[model samples]
Target: MSRYLFALGQLVARRRWWVLAVWIVLLVGAICFAAGTGGKTNDNFTVPGTESQDAVSLLQQRMPTFSGAQMQVVFATPGLAKVTDQQVRAEIEQTMAGLQGLPQVAQVVDPFQAQAVSPDQRVALGTVQFSVSAGEVDADTLDGVDRIAGPAREAGLEVQFSGAVYPGFTADIPHTPEILGIVAAFVILLITFGAVVAAGLPIVTALVGVGIGLTGILGVAAFVDVPSAATSLALMLGLSCGIDYALFILSRHRHNIVLGMPAAESIPLAVGTAGSSVVFAAVTVIIALCGLTVAGIPFLTVMGLTAAGAVLVAMLVALTLLPALLGFAGDTVAKFISPPLHPGKAEEVARIAAYEPERTCGHAWGRFVTRFRIPLLVLGIAILAVVAIPATRMDLGLPSGATQAESSTARKAYDLVSRSFGPGFNGPLLVVTDLSHATGADAAQTLMGRLRQESNVAAVQPGGSGNGMLLIQVFPKTGPNDSATTDLVNRLRDDRDRIESGTGATYLVGGTTAANIDTSNRLAAALPVFLAVVVGLALLLLTIAFRTVLVPLSSIVGFMLSVFAALGAQVAVFQWGWGASLFHVAKAQTLSFLPIITLAIIFGLSSDYQIFVVSRIKEEHTRTADAIASVQNGVAHSARVVTAAALIMFGVFVAFTAVDNPIVKPLAFTLAVGVLFDAFIVRLTLVPAVMALIGNRMWYHPRWFARYIPDLDIEGAELERRFAHDAEVEVPQGITGVS
Candidate 1:
């Protein structure tokens, strides 16, 4: 693989301009294709085998009118004591008529006709049923709704839209986060390299790669159900990994140039070594992400594949395009970028030139940590434990409208409905009953009576029967995001025996709230399986790569700690509402997808640093035959690059929080925090400390397993050997080139 990568780098270098032009053409074509396709993203998260899905399927088949996209048009006259005024009613009626006249609107139910006025009568609720699913609703249909609501707004009445279609109307894939993240990455790169041109290369390469990947997603969305959230995630991963991969190779190439190796030699050498690590790291991430399919959820599968595609693009760009760009720059780049700082400069250059591990700050820290290995390990574990405490109480559920931004019209509608009608008015549970039998009507009536008797049931209304099936709208006392609502969903499903025996009817509880509950429960149930697959696969890969048992075991343990700490931080900020004001989030509830998504991405990303750092340690140990020295030198050699990469990823991920979407915010923040802990604490501190304590045992493996396991050569030991041999044979004695 290294030889092939080296040859590819050489080819790109020789044909730098052509290679660069090809990338440009590909990027521009992708952009044009994406724009031409212009497909909508669906945010629907449905599990096929779930009860909620089954109920939804039945509802669609039986009651087509009610099954379509439903929207609530909230009207309020804040100054008015009640909405009973004839003039106000007339204006609202006109609005309702206009809504009914819209081409996409299948039906509109006026509050006055339905007599669904609020208790205070200051608020009125009108229902609009669309002819298509919420995900299928076009922008023009939403615009038409807005146009119709203009009259009510002009009449001194507040009009707000709420429901599934609201997200569709407001959904957007913005470049602000990606642009900001790139800007932040550039600054970090500038600091790491201390050269403008050096820093710019990684940023430019990453942007190009990420641009292609993101545009590719748009193209993919034209045919498949790619959720809007998937694009954001892809963008986030693409930028971070793109920059990190390019930086890894660029850093190594620069080190070689500083050692006086020719650009041609250094470029391929860097590609063979650093580029190999990037490939291995990226594969681990891809494998981990692909493992999400084990959960058997379409949304997660799409998300994982989308992100993995982006990472793959980034890795390829690093190996191919970046090297070509580097080749084009050549000695000119060497002339501009500054050399390493003093304090045994020659020794440092020599070590880097030969790919020998050095004793830098990471080394010093490793030695210091070794002296107090037990204490450092304990402290590290304790800190993680402290942050992870909140994870135990983490609530796994999608955010309700209540958590929407205060400025959002949907939020105002949610608040208004909660204050007037009831909290449950925001998410009414649909008690769908299969009534193919002649006795179904009698069963429905008996079930309605029983539902009305329940203390938690706020109201029960017959939701009109059709096609031999009856639907009952049951409103609970709690809001959709409330635990009480989930409990109610479970309660209704569990009481199937009683309900079915008494009424001779089978009931399925489903609604926006119920769907969320079901989705969350399903994901929660699949979490263990997903974790096992991801962790187990990663362990196998790491063991194969490093040829060790303890190292992979320690790596997995550290990865979990970082993940737990990240989740804990998310729980603290989002779920516990601690410092929520900073993020402009008012409510305290974790999105159900946050943990699952975070674990998959973060675990994969963390492995990159772990493999790079550990691979260096193993290389040093092979050379020195001293575990302690290997630990110090290995950490010292790789720490700067690892830390720089982490900071770049951290900046990119943190910038994602700047996006307006609430779902993207927590995910970005969690990833940003996770990268920080994984880089600074786990990879840098705890890992080294633990390895130091373990000593040679860090490389321990079963004797039988050793014969079967092959060395991955992720560090490109063969490439290093070839480079050394070629240099010794080809270079003149007087030349001060890389040895």
Candidate 2:
């Protein structure tokens, strides 16, 4: 592995311009191809083989008019008893006619014709049907509807649109968050390196890598059904990982140069050493992300693949592009853009001191922790447990319109409809029945009566029938995200035998709400499997790399603790409504996919830090044959790099919270918190303390098994072996061997 990395680095460094030019060409071509394709991304969460999906399929097949892309244009005339005035009625009718005339409109149901006007007469809903599915509707059709609603708005009436596709139409890729994240990362790097040129290298490398990855993702969308949120997720992961990967290699190169190695020797040495860890870390992340396929969710599968591709690209760029750039810059790269503080010039001098591989904050802190290992370990565990308590009450569901920004047209429409009609109006359930074997009309009538009589049922209306199936719309009294609605769905499905007794009819309760419930349930069932697979794979990889049992076990356990703590924080803010307003959350419900997705990403990222830190400790142990000194020195050596990397990632993740999209915001917050907890509490505190207490046992492994497992040497022990003999020959004048 070291040889290969060394060869690759030397090749890129020698052909730096050619390498850089090739990347530029690929990036440009990718951008052009993506723009030309201009493919659409959808957030459809249909779970194949689920009852809700089956119902949707049946409806689309048999009752096409009722099943196609549907949106509601809500109208409210405040201060008027009802919208019954002749002029208002004429205007609404004309608007309906105009909507129906659009080429995309399959049909438009007028409020007057459908008798959908509220009993109070202050509000009315006009349903528009599009020829394609909600996700398939083009922007032009949505724009046409918006234009048709203009006259009503101008006539002193409130008009708003709300539907599955309505939010998508208004959603914008949040550029503000990405920009702020990059800026924050730059500031962090500047502080860490104390030089503009040194700081900019990581940021520049990361942006280039993420740019290519995101563009490639767009091309992938042209052929596959990628979720709209996938790009944002890719960006978040790509930027952080790209910067961190480059930072690791760049830092190592600088340290080597400070030790008197020339640019030619230092570049390959840095690449061969830190680059191996980057590869290992990247592979772990890719494995954990790709494991999403076991969940059997199409969106998750595609999302995972997209994110993995981005991480892979970032790793490649860090290994190739960063080295080439370093080579091109040569000795000038070591010079700080900002001059270092004068010697003995107060605390600032301590902060801006030149790189010293022998001494680090970690070394001092490791010794302190070792002296009070038990107390520190206990304290760390207690803190994590306290923070993780909120996870116990997590309630997962898709964000409904109520959670949308109040200023959004969709939210305004939802509020108006809920106030005038009912919360149930926002998400009506479609109960479809195959009545071929029963007295069709009578069975339908019986089912409708039964549904209307149920306590939770707000309204039961005939939803048209075709062929051998009967469709009935059942509106629950509660909103879609309400627990009562989920209960109603479960009750209807579970009690089908009692409800349809002697009717010989099959009933399926489905809608946007039911689909959400199904998706949540399916993911919940798959969670255990997903966790087991991810953990098993990570344990195997760690065991092979470290040649130890307790080390891998400890790493996995620490990862879980960090994940739980992060989740608890998320649930407290988003679900419990604590600090919800701070994050712009209008309502408190955990996004259904948040926990699972965060867990996968956090696990992978946490493993990266774990491997880098532990690999260093193991290397020190092997070289010195002193467990205690090795643990302390190793941590001291790796602490600064790990903390800086963590801060960079934390900033990127936090910036994503600025995005208005509910789905992206909570995910970002959780990931940010997870990184912080893992870095400071788990890796920096708990890990070293626990390893100190365990001493040599931390590296214990069965001799037979150790022989079978290949040494990963992620810290580049092999590279050091090849280069140690050349150190004296390569050392510049005035630089002597250590001590």
Candidate 3:
């Protein structure tokens, strides 16, 4: 792997202009193709094989009119004695008239006819129904609806929209988060690299990679139902991972340059060594992402694959495009646009000081940790354990309107509907009962009476009955994402057998609220399977790389601590509402899939830290045969790049929280906190402390065991063996060796 990467890097550097042109053309072509034929992203939030989906399917087959997507158009004003002003009523009636003219409209239910006007006369709910599925409803239909609402808005009434078909956010990439993240990356990189071009190169390569990845997803959206969150996740992972990969290689190249190696020579050498580690890191992430299929959710599967594709592109950019750009810069890759901090020192000395951290802070910290290894290890564990306490009481659910920005229409509409009708009105349940075999004169009505008697049931209305199937709309007293609602759903299902025995009829609970319940249950069940399959397999794979049992075991332990700590932080801040105002979370609950996704993503990234840090120690230990000193030297060798990469990734993830997106915000926050704990505390503090305590026993892979596990040459040990005699250029043999 190292030899091939070395040759490939040399080829790319030699043909720098061609390599640059190819990437430019690919990015431009993707953008052009997406512009002409891109597909719109829509959320088809359903879990296949769930009872709720089955009920929906049965409804579509039997009752086509009501089964189609329905939009709730809310009209509100300051409390009025008349309930609704005559002019406001006139405006709403006009909008309904315009909606009737749309060719696809099946029916428009009038608010006055349905008596949907609140008792206060300040709020009204009207439904615009269509025959197509929510995912099939085009933007043209939505736009037409929005346009008709203009008159109502102009009539001193607030008009807001919320329903299955309405988009939660615009298609435009979240500019605030992405832009802020890039700016933060520039600052971090500038400080880390101490050179303008060096910092900019990573940002440039990362954007190109992310641009192509996102465009590809956009183009694929033309064919499939891509959730808007997929693009945001891809952007977050692609940009951060891209920069880190490039940083790893660039850091290596600078080290070589200061050590007397020519720029051209160092470029390939960097790729052969650091690029191998990048490939390892990227492959792990892709595998973990692809593992989302275990949950059997279509939207999440799309998200995982899209994110994996983006990561693959980022790795390729770091291996190929970054080297080409470095070739173009020539010796200037070693020069700083800003003056060196230690003026009057030799340029090499300043350059070395800027790029090679093992000499100063890295070594000093290494010594302190190793000297107090036991106490530091215990302290790290204690801190993470305390932070993880909130995770035990976590509450997971789908993001609701409450999770939205308070200023958004969806949020406003949600608030108005809850205040006017009831909190349960936002999440009404559709009960489908096959009452053909009714034992009594009115078994369906008897069942409805039973539902109304339940303490949680707020209202039970007739929802149309036909073909021996009775539909009942049951409204719970609690909000959609409330724990009380979840309990009520379970209680309702539990009483199904008893009701059927008395009525001689079968029934199911279905609707958006019910579907959310089913999805969360399904995700929770699959989480264990995912952990056993994906996490177990990942640990086994890491074992092959480390070629030891204890190192991999230690890594997994640290990963678990980091993940739980991060989750605990999320539960405290989001669920417990501790500092929730800072993030603008209108609701205090985490998303259902967030825990599993965080574990998968953080596990993959955790391996990167383990391999990068431990591989250096392994190399040093092999060369010097002194375990204690090797721990210090290895940490000193890799700490600078590891710290910079981790910080860059942490900042990028946090930047995504700047957007008002409900899905992206919490997901990014979890990832950012996970990275912070994993990188800074687990990898840097605990891993080293553990390694110092373990000593030589840490490298206990038997020679016989080495035969079964392939040596990936991730540290470029083979390259070192082959290039050891290159005295003129002072080629560093071991990737673990300090320049």
Candidate 4:
């Protein structure tokens, strides 16, 4: 470790151009690399082989051998007078004729056909099935939808179109993450250091890091199934956190320079202290996120690993690229157009004499903590407890099209189909069974009868896989989140043993509901593993940094309490009707993946802030040899800066909720509340109070561990001595404000 530090010192002292050139070349190459890669399929939020997918595949396979059409288009209004009238039919026919002429379109089922409408004839619906193979959905298939939809809207009728195509293609997935990432990087740096050049440096370094990372991820995609579109979000987050850590170190380096240290000496001095914190914080976040691999869901597992990979790249970039940039920029990096706010001579005098016995610990930290400790601790706990209240009532479920904005064509189409045909019109069920024996038919018939008796079931019919398969159409009573889906799944599972025993066959239930329920169950089962990883990783890193057994444990407890509080608050907003209209989501909307997503995102973010605070406190404690004094000084110094950073971060996250997509809203909501709680409550208040109470005893470590660990000089003692020796030179007359 010391050798690496010394090597870094040499690199700075020698002013190596190769390091800067290499970074520039790699960054430029990465840009070309990304541009070279062509567009790839997006599978981030897709489940490939569920029953609906299989049904579509089977239809495509049979399309070449068989008949007219399989999908439908419906026209709806207050009434059907204009739709059923002759002029309307002529216009509709003209549109249908245009569609029929297309090479890929097989046939257009006329809505005016008597068989299409129900008894009252309030709705006139059309059916369109393409001549193309059922096995694939390509441009030709989507073009057919657009061809008819475009003309129908011009005919002045209320028309909504729903099929498997729109749900798979046209849902509004927001693109806010990119803007959020750019803005977040700027905000964190500006707030942390208060210098424009200092703020801009992190953004530049992080972009290079993320650019390299994206190139690597694109390469990895050839060997694995990566979630295509949303990978950008992970890359963005890694860049933001990574850059923040680097700036933390660089700002400290600039502070040393301002105090008269030579540039070369300040580099190692900063690296040994803040650079070390950056590495540990990055690693801890990586570990927490990567813990999602235990869940065994390929989508989540891929996301976790990819996100972790990006953070690792960010760390390396910050350490290498940032140092070189700082070495190149020198004192000019801290030169702002506006002058720094200079503290009065009395404050300077007090700071210069701060090390004296009369003032050092007794006067500085002792006076401060005695005056303010209880109030700080009380405010923190109160905020955490209050904000976290909503998490307790959290309801978890899959996202649905009905939750989309009414203006979206997909949502409008879904509503029409659901009202005109059946509630589960968009998604139906498929039951697969082994049917090699006589009992197979009997068991299948019995299951069919039970399904027919269900109130929410619209119909049951034979489907693909020959004798073993049955397609059951369920009219979901309460839409996606209704208790009916969960109830039906449980009932089927309860009856599975008897049916399987009698038929000597295995039965599997596969559908939208079943797929959602299975995913929920898997996540629930994996929660313990995820929590264990988060807590275990925090303990490992904190122990290494603090060297105390109980301090890490206490920190974990405090963090867990904060997490519970955040989750509880989420529950109240989503499950209860606290802020429904304000957030623009359904009062009862629940995201099925909330727990796992929150675990990965919130845990990492919270831990990031926690490490920043604790690192400063630990630094102060080492300097003063007094626990309470260290806690007071560290909190006072860190609180304002961290709070501002957190506020900026919170704004970036909260902005995403305004987008018109269901998936993005939950992510934004959880992240925003979590950041606020972590910034103001958990990090600012609870952590400081606990450190104050624990005091000097927090550094206690086993003698066995201490012996193996070499001492790291983060105090800048050598550089300070060198600068003091060089201070005999006269100050420049132009710089009139010298103390």
**Each model's TM-score, in the order given?**
0.93, 0.95, 0.93, 0.82
Candidate 1 per-residue C-alpha lDDT over 1-739 given as tens digits, one digit per residue, 9 for 90 to 100: 6787888888898899998999999999999989999965787667888887888787777777667667888899868546778989898999999989876677788889878798888999887877677777777778888888888888799989898775334567477777788788888876666567678898888889889998999888888888788888888898899999998899888877766778999898899888878998999888877877777788888998999999999998999999998987876554444345543343333343334333245566767877888888899899988998899998888867787778788888999999989898788888887777646446777878888887678888766577777778788998888888888888888877876775667789887788888888878888898898888888888888888878888888988999999999999998888998898877557888778787888788888998888888887887787888888888877877888899889988888887767788888999999999888889888998888888888887788887899866778778877776444433223323221
lDDT of 3 by residue, 1-739 (tens): 8899999899999999999999999999889878878577778776899888888788777777667666777888755534357777787788878887775677777788667888788888887777777777777877787787787777677888776655443535558888888898888887776678888999999999999998989888999888889999999999999999999999888877766678888899889988888898899889989999899998889999999999999999999999999998877766765455654233433344434545556777788889999899889999999999999998778877677788877788889999988888777788877777889877877898888988788888776677778778788888899889888888888878876677888888888788888989988998888878766866787787777888888988998999899999999888898898898886457788898888788988998888888888887787888888888888887887799899999999998887788788888999999999999899888998998898999888888889888877778877766655455443233222222
lDDT of each: 0.81, 0.83, 0.83, 0.62
Better of 1 and 2 by lDDT: 2
Q: Model 4 off-target regions past 4 Å? A: 1-6, 9-16, 39-41, 44-74, 82-140, 157-177, 180-188, 191-194, 215-223, 339-372, 433-447, 461-470, 497-507, 702-739
Quick one: RMSD of model 2? Answer: 3.0
Candidate 2 minimal-lDDT segment of 10 residues: 344-353
- Score candidate 4 by TM-score against the native: 0.82
Backbone clash numbers for all candidates listed? 0, 1, 2, 14
CA RMSD for every model? Answer: 3.6, 3.0, 3.3, 5.5
Candidate 4 worst ten-residue window by lDDT: 349-358
In angstroms, give how far residue 661 of model 3 lies from its true place. 1.1
> Any residue pairs clashing in model 1, and if so which?
none
Model 4 agreement with the true structure over 195-288: per-residue lDDT tens digits: 6677787788777787777776766665666654346446546566666666666766766665566777777666655666667668777887
Off by over 4 Å in 1: 167-169, 336-359, 440-444, 500-505, 725-739
Count: clashes, candidate 2: 1
